[model samples]
Target: AMHPMRSEHIRAAVKRARGNRKEIVNKIEESLTHCLAREGLEGEVLGREKHIYGIYQKMRGKRRAFNEIMDVYGFRIIVDKVDTCYRVLGAVHNLYKPLPGRFKDYIAIPKANGYQSLHTTLFGMHGVPIEIQIRTREMEEMANNGIAAHWLYKSNEEDQPKGTHARARQWVKGVLEMQQRAGNSLEFIESVKIDLFPDEVYVFTPKGRIMELPKGSTAVDFAYAVHTDVGNTCIACRINRRLAPLSEPLQSGATVEIVSAPGARPNPAWLNFVVTGKARTHIRHALKLQRRSESISLGERLLNKVLGGFDSHIDKLSPERVQAVLAEYRQSALEDLLEDIGLGNRMAYVVARRLLSESGEELPSPEGPLAIRGTEGLVLSYAKCCTPIPGDPIVGHLSAGKGMVVHLDTCRNIGEVRHNPEKCIQLSWAKDVVGEFNVELRIELEHQRGLIALLAGSVNAADGNIEKISMDERDGRISVVQLVVSVHDRVHLARVIKKLRAIKGVVHISRVRA
Candidate 1:
């Protein structure tokens, strides 16, 4: 009776008296004669006996009984070539019953740290389990010392650093790239340390190249591991030849293909699921750059908006006047001053006044409210409370670090601050506002069979997308449904509501504002 086993399995097997350790050892050695005697396939049989670990640390980290973990034991065979490693595997499995699904050929798909070997679990005599590893002699050394083994191995210079050493060099090069993009020393170390963590899942690319990623890593991690550019523009991923979520946890042996789009930018949401330090570091760097560009654009718009009222344009201002404003604000450049204004750290109105200090003590009243084209990017956000859309009268709230938060003019959340000229300003939707707006709706409807389906069909027919929907039973006959829907504008929303109102069971519907 033979199969695969762990250290615990070996300990349990020994307790059952499965021929003594010497008999097992002799049988394993005899595997060479059974399969690898003449075909230039031979290697040294090395004993890798069970080794114990710190009791307290193992107990605390594994949260398992100490005695249960002591059953591990295995053997390692070091051959001369990669092909022989596999041949010996056949020989060993022939001698001992190898456990099904317990065999792993890391040689085909090396670990992230560049370690390659053939691992198998077998059942020895009397139902005892045993673990074994087979690899080339160089692999054994590389496994033990990793990149540091480079200095220890005294191979001929002509041998060069191909295989393990090359992988190590590539890894080191990645670390240098992370260091360059990291925001600070702490960020660099934090990002670099995660890559040093153990690589547990091995995956493959579409081109048959194997990649080793840490367990729990996502496709974004795989994308970043491929290259920073690929990661930045990746819109989706295909795992194992099928479209999969970018945040899906990767499993070993799955083929991953990243789908990229031209001009597509990294989603800030990816930060939530990305596990690799490289992905995190690169995403943050890209976002920082994106925000800087957005801030500069927004700052220019704000300055120009205010200058409109004083009957002056930012371009019309003299260089000396601009320099004086920067000096007064202790800003090194006009861009810095504008960024501050864009982020709401400095009031644009105040800056506008200072920029015109030389003109005169009295300045003409500013023009109409700033127009929002819905392209302000990260600096400008719509208030979640009111969910304002185009065609609605909106006001801008100057929130520190948030730039502008747009809300319906009637939204009470900003009622107190609305009167404060420094913190709030009127805003008008530009004629060419782009993109959809999300709004939550509460629908009172009769509790009828297939009610949800009807609602969905109606909204779908009206060209509206439902982001989320929840139902609350008011009683046996009536129910209230709350749904988050995306529409292009107020008109689009009205159209969706009208379609829903046509349904027989729908009692009433109104947009949810809070």
Candidate 2:
């Protein structure tokens, strides 16, 4: 009482309060337990940095005022077992009513960093919020030191690296794998972008091993996480023991199994559906490799046709001359030059002209149309608008960076450019175009029971697959059906149309071209 109101007196007071910190903690715990017991709680409140710096950081981070900050007697509940942790949580709630939607059970779905605890905020005495966390002692140590705790653990416990320690080690391993597998820095950055998602879902493999993925991740992401090879060859998936689409978004607790085929490869369309960086990068890399091989092949064919006009062939061109041309084009090899021509990034005509410039040959363009086998991989794609099949008259549009896109010669989209030799080329289907091409059909029919079954049966009878189907009711008596049928060629399409025309109550049917 006689002390002066100076800096020395304030410092002394602060020192004395610091000495009483443990006593204050004991009293707080005692009062907390007493309050919970009074409220009929069966367990004790087991266990925090609302101290100056932590409080300041929170204020800066959340833009919350100092008064809005919550405290739990500046400590969390620490128990010896997971079961006791729940009991303590019940006691805490019995003492203070909980804030709605403020509880998080992270033990079921751990955070991306492998942190697991039960967290909640309660309306404490005086209506202040008390944020509480309940965890075991091991979790407390892991939460405090993170992965560093792996190293900090005493050597005597080296064999107990099964729980938090193993998880942290696994996280390190995953990071290293991601870094090593990235094609470049930008690819690495793209691959890791999914990790930035704050929410994650936990699913199980068919083998019962738990896997964590970003929320909204699909079966494709899960497959890639299993292994790159499994992803590359995966054709279908089973989610929770039922056949599911590869694009189906996975849910927590589901067991996912990938169905792989021996020779299946990644589809460029997969890039449209996949969410993870690893799947995207791997798909792109595989497509790039596939495109290179296809481009080199197509490029060689184009160059040889031009060379044929000059009474020369690629095989006959001297190695030195080829190297000189490669240097002129700044291409490392003949394949590189061909790949450029194939991809349409560099004009085939220009490269052909340069190759024969030394011969002073005035050559007319090569005569025959380029043949399409329908298996040109990623470098060649058929136009969706025209839906050109094997029997349709087609022309190739050399789309830069996208290789070739084949369109019907009569397609309105390419009418102006059909005769432009540089960008468009005459193209014809080979004797055997190997794959099915999608053709849209519009059918008007009297609405009747089992109409869908009849149409499906007809298409199946004609050996056609309906890729998609939709119907619109016109007047409640009539309906218009749109079908996307996949067939081998125009003849095959005609057969399918004939089958549809035979169905009862069919009004009119026609192909849809756009």
Candidate 3:
């Protein structure tokens, strides 16, 4: 049914199927018990007919057709030992034709919820499908009540022995581990759902230890399941003695060997294929820590560079000076301030200026634009309004939240904040700027076939890298083209513009701001 039905409808359906279910269960239990007795096997045989509400809920959850629900009639055979359970399973299979691919051996590889059993669906009299479960008494208790089965047997801690239900205890411990790693309550609950996955594949490690992961899990998931460190440093892996991609889905009984390097780190792409909550949580935690550490280092360097301008150093700063800076920023500690700067949450130079001002030290003033090193890292960003290049005479404006913004001195946008000299910093081009800068140009060209190609070729000839090109058709004959190109310096950009002007169809070319 596409929609859920009323309670009365479900009750009526269960009532109609009750007699058939009882007959099927009785026949299967009789056949199994008789077969086991003849084979000199001793165990308890039980049968169950699921309640109407339980069946309805399961059907709705799985969105299965009414006829597709096969486990309405179930039987369980409980033995004294694990081996006896397997013997019961083999005997049951011999009595009835077993359905292909309809058997699961959870005894060898327990489910994440600590469920262990041998499940088989077989075709019985009149082609009716019946499901049989074979397990030991202990496993029967676990499959029925999960972790609560342990508490039901032991009245108190003193009555319980250590390592009793160890697998269930480990599952509970994993829940706590996920809780600690999750960002919030909702995330913790979501991770718990992933841990309770019903379908799984059993794979082996190089050491021959079995790992039961959810079906469709990748090599990265296996790595994390083995150990967090292994997942973090995993660079490559060999599956069944053959090299395989990390994203490849692992198969049952495959021997997986992780190849890791000390310097290797997690890739963000691992989050896409990993099915286990443990892998996703560990990767996210590692990446966050990595970002924080990098930010701290970058912040420290930026602060030291600013201090060096005043003939001082970060290591030489006294405790009192550091405390004063922290107080100025309203930060509880120095690391917090440094981390904020490193993450671009605060400006390093501003903090340095405030600290020096508090010390009653006269800060040196640049007579003209201060030269840039182009290697300021996260501490400096070019102003979008002017898009200053290396050869331009630029002024540095310290935005309140943004670290530093470099703009051409003649930019009209500079006039708005020029009254506040404290926010205005002198800047000049570095002697050896390391990287190219983005510059935009506007070209008025006569529209013709292959004209765009000619323009692109000319830019390449002048060693300019085209970043983007947007064209507007003013009319069929004329098109206004905007090009964004990467250049080393003003001279290189000027050469590119000259080359573009020499093109056959180009009428005029001018540098566009921003």
In model 2, which regions exceed 4 Å deviation? 1-47, 50-74, 77-193, 268-275, 308-315, 412-416, 440-461, 465-484, 500-514
Worst 10 residues of 2 by lDDT: 1-10
Q: TM-score, each model? A: 0.79, 0.69, 0.73
Better of 1 and 3 by TM-score: 1
Go through the candidates in order and give each one's C-alpha lDDT: 0.83, 0.79, 0.80
Candidate 2's TM-score reads 0.69
Q: Pick the candidate with the highest TM-score.
A: 1
Over 4 Å off in model 1, which ranges?
A: 1-46, 49-51, 54-71, 79-97, 122-130, 151-160, 184-193, 316-333, 358-365, 440-457, 468-484, 500-514
- Write the residue-wise lDDT of candidate 3 on 338-406 in tens digits: 878766577666778877786787765423455677766444788877888988878877664455678
- Model 3 residue 193 lDDT? 86
| Candidate 3 local lDDT, residue 69 | 70
Whole-model alpha-carbon lDDT for candidate 2: 0.79
